[model samples]
Target: MNIVLFGATGNIGKVILQEALDRGHHVTAIVRDPAKLSVQNPNLKVATGDLLRPASYEASLAGADAAIASVNDPDPDNVPKQAQVLLDTLAKAGVKRFAWVGGAGSLEVAPGVRVIDDPNFPPAWKPSAMGMVKALDVFRASKADIDWTFISPAAHIEPGERTGKYRVGGDQLLVDAQGNSHISQADYAIGLLDRLEKGDAARKRITLAY
Candidate 1:
């Protein structure tokens, strides 16, 4: 598959990039600074582009199979703004498939109780989390015929073991026997690739945990 990736230097984005290359898929890593990307692979091509500017990366979208965005702009608030632009750009390119690396905030802890609504939710992360929520709304409300999937990570995601194991759920938070919702960065990327390849969670929001 010819995959176009955004935010290839981020925590989750880097892992996902490696996973895609490991799977033998042709990938184009779109970034502002090509120098920041150190990975060199025959299947990898780095493209210089800005997410908000369609013309910057639209050329790279030609003949693409799908695009995945693990997007985190300098201003987290720009997530929603870029989302619309991204959809428009994809439509113009005739790329109907997209996958977004989503946040846990929007997942329901209980009926009508989102992770962001939890009293224990950190205030420091609210701004970015809310930005993800608005971006999600943009995806949901879009009239374009894009087959998009939003993959939300567990509540506590960080560098840890890959384990190559995980569980999946929709909208609601998934927890283990210990009642903790967590997934390693590696496993989260693994899940995203699995979802993309398997096409099991297309055009919907799904959470990953273990």
Candidate 2:
């Protein structure tokens, strides 16, 4: 498969790029600066471009089997805009399949209560969380024929050893026997790649955790 990946230098994006390459897929990593991407492989190509300006990298999206975006911004307000550009770019480029590295805040903890609505939700993270929620809304409201899949990680995600093992869920948050929701960054990458390869979760949002 040929894949075009955005945010190739981000924490999760880098891992996803590696995961794709290890699977023998040809990956074109789009980044603002090519030097920032340290990975070099026969199957990997780094393209210089900007996410907000899809025209800068529209050629890279064409003829790609799938596109995955792990790009994130500290300012939550900007994420949705980036998502909008991504969708428009992919649509214009004629790439029908896409996978977005989503935020967990939109996942429901109850019938109508989202994880971001919980009182215990960190105040500092609210903006970013809500930003992701808005991004999901943008995707849901889109009328394009793109087979878009959004994968939100566990409540807590950080760098950790990749066990290549984790559980999956939809809409609702996935918790372990101890009621804990978390997953390592490496394993989360594994889950994202699995979703891309299977294409079973298209046009839906799924969560991954322990």
The candidate that wins on TM-score is 1
**lDDT at 174 for candidate 1?**
95
Candidate 1 has an lDDT of 0.91
Q: What's the TM-score of every candidate structure?
A: 0.97, 0.96
Clash number for model 1? 0
Model 1: pairs clashing at backbone N, Cα or C within 3 Å: none
Clashes of 2: 0
RMSD score of candidate 1 (Å): 1.0
lDDT of 1 at 5: 97
lDDT at 177 for candidate 1? 97
